[model samples]
Target: MSLAPRAVLVHRRTEYEELIAHHGTPGQAAFFLASRGRSVAEVEQRHRRQAEALARAAAAVPLDWRRTRVERADLPRFLFEPEDVVVVVGQDGLVANVAKYLDGQPVVGVDADPGRNPGVLVRHRADALAALLPAAARSGARHLEERTMVEAVADDTQRLLALNEVYVGQPGHQTARYRLAVDGEPAEPQASSGVLVGTGTGATGWCRSAWLERGGPLALPGAAAPALAWFVREAWPSPATGTAQVHGLLDAGRQLVLTVESDRLVAFGDGIEADALELTWGQTIRLGVAPTRLRLLG
Candidate 1:
């Protein structure tokens, strides 16, 4: 196995306890070590208390602790072979500090406040964990092939961590124009400061705000799942000024495009850009979704 149950790849999160309280392997299971000691002495003390409590749970799970592993979590000294990991989480995001050698495990969050509503907690936790766990052991950092897209110009499949949408809003900027084309199909582009093309998975973030302001169609806001709850938060103006005539269906890979622009513009993602590729107002970018997305542990 890549990681022993209580061995390495441990990330300490705030509610790691509350989260573990719910999804933790119930039966007598050993914890490789104790408190990772990041926050303070008091915090370390809490790990001992929590470990003891976990030891006494009705499930009677084994909470055996080895020596205090100190600051790092790693593969057991004897288990040199690598195994994919199951990230242990708690109520306070990811228990980033306590768990052992979480070097390359598929980390998952348990829940922040399972007490508030146990069912809800598991629903979210499971949703996140299901996809994350497997990725840890099997993923290779490379774009195998593009199997996704949101617009016809590129792929926007449900990538784990998406680069995000583009928004050009400053109140005073005039909307840009471009002729839309899917593989060179002429679909005239409308005028807008900038058009936002987000991964279907990223429909809710700030891009949606732009959607609302632009009077775009009211899409149902769901959990970004295939059939999750979707409510029409906001949309663009009448006639869909910057609508995707053939926003090709993105699957789960990379995308590429070639655009011929006739204007000057710069776009933003999440708000800032580390790099920019100029599109002469109408040049198409072969934007493809990446295969790997990092899981932000608690």
Candidate 2:
């Protein structure tokens, strides 16, 4: 007999939880927030709402099905199964945070607070999970929207994935030194803050800001476009490093290559610098469209 499908509820610690963790008690957290002209009641209210949403989500799970809960911090260490239905409850970024760790699993993005987040990835409220979860378990019962994702693979075979964008640069905010080569272009030595490779899903965020700041040279891709947009952040025009190759579009199957000349560079996705690929001098990392797409449920 086939095993029953599992429902994995993913969430991050709330501000209230973090505050209490740091301050040791509610009273202490309240005092700390009061000093900053903030209200602890607001934090407590948000915490209560989050707890209620989680409770509703938990109650929606089918009685016969197995249920698991995971926090955002533990996603890197969490093991996901193909048959598991992934439910992300929190902000839209939480969906991005978990997308890298999943392998074609159907994901349900749940917004704990409706108006708190920009309903990009997390489109549904907690009450919808009661109906969505069972349908998701039934093979091909619901529409699954596939969102494009970017991948960075190092020479050492370390690969990183991002739903929004991947940043390749120094750990600190220093200028990065590298030789950049894109498809149909000659390799050029360039000094810049870093390189950003992003998917259509991420075009509205960092990628859009970078593009607009540079006179909007390239058209940003849509959320489901099977393409990627890249930019060179603040490229320095020096005799040794040229700024000719600053930005471009990467269609499917195309790649942008960067050969590090700096002592060390790190490749991280979705702004999670804590987890990244460390690149050394002479190391080459390839950035391109990932083979895997995020199967987001609508």
lDDT of 1 by residue, 1-298 (tens): 2333332222233334443555464221123122333333343445654443222221221133111222122322324223434333333212322212233333433442345434211223433443443343346623111111122222222111222444332223555554443334555444544445554434555556655654664453332322111111122344644444423333334332324344654434433333233345434544434333323333
Question: How well is each residue in 1-298 modelled by candidate 2, as lDDT tens digits?
Answer: 8888999999999999999999999899999989999899987888888888899999999999999999999999999998899999888999999999999889999888888889899999899888999887777755888999999999999999999999999999699999999966789999999999999999979999999999988788887898999999999998899999889999998999999999999999999999999999999999999999999998
| CA lDDT, candidate 1, residue 3 | 34
- Cα distance off (Å), candidate 1, residue 110: 8.6
- List lDDT for all candidates, in order: 0.35, 0.93
The TM-score that candidate 1 achieves is 0.37
Residue ranges of candidate 2 with Cα displaced over 4 Å: none
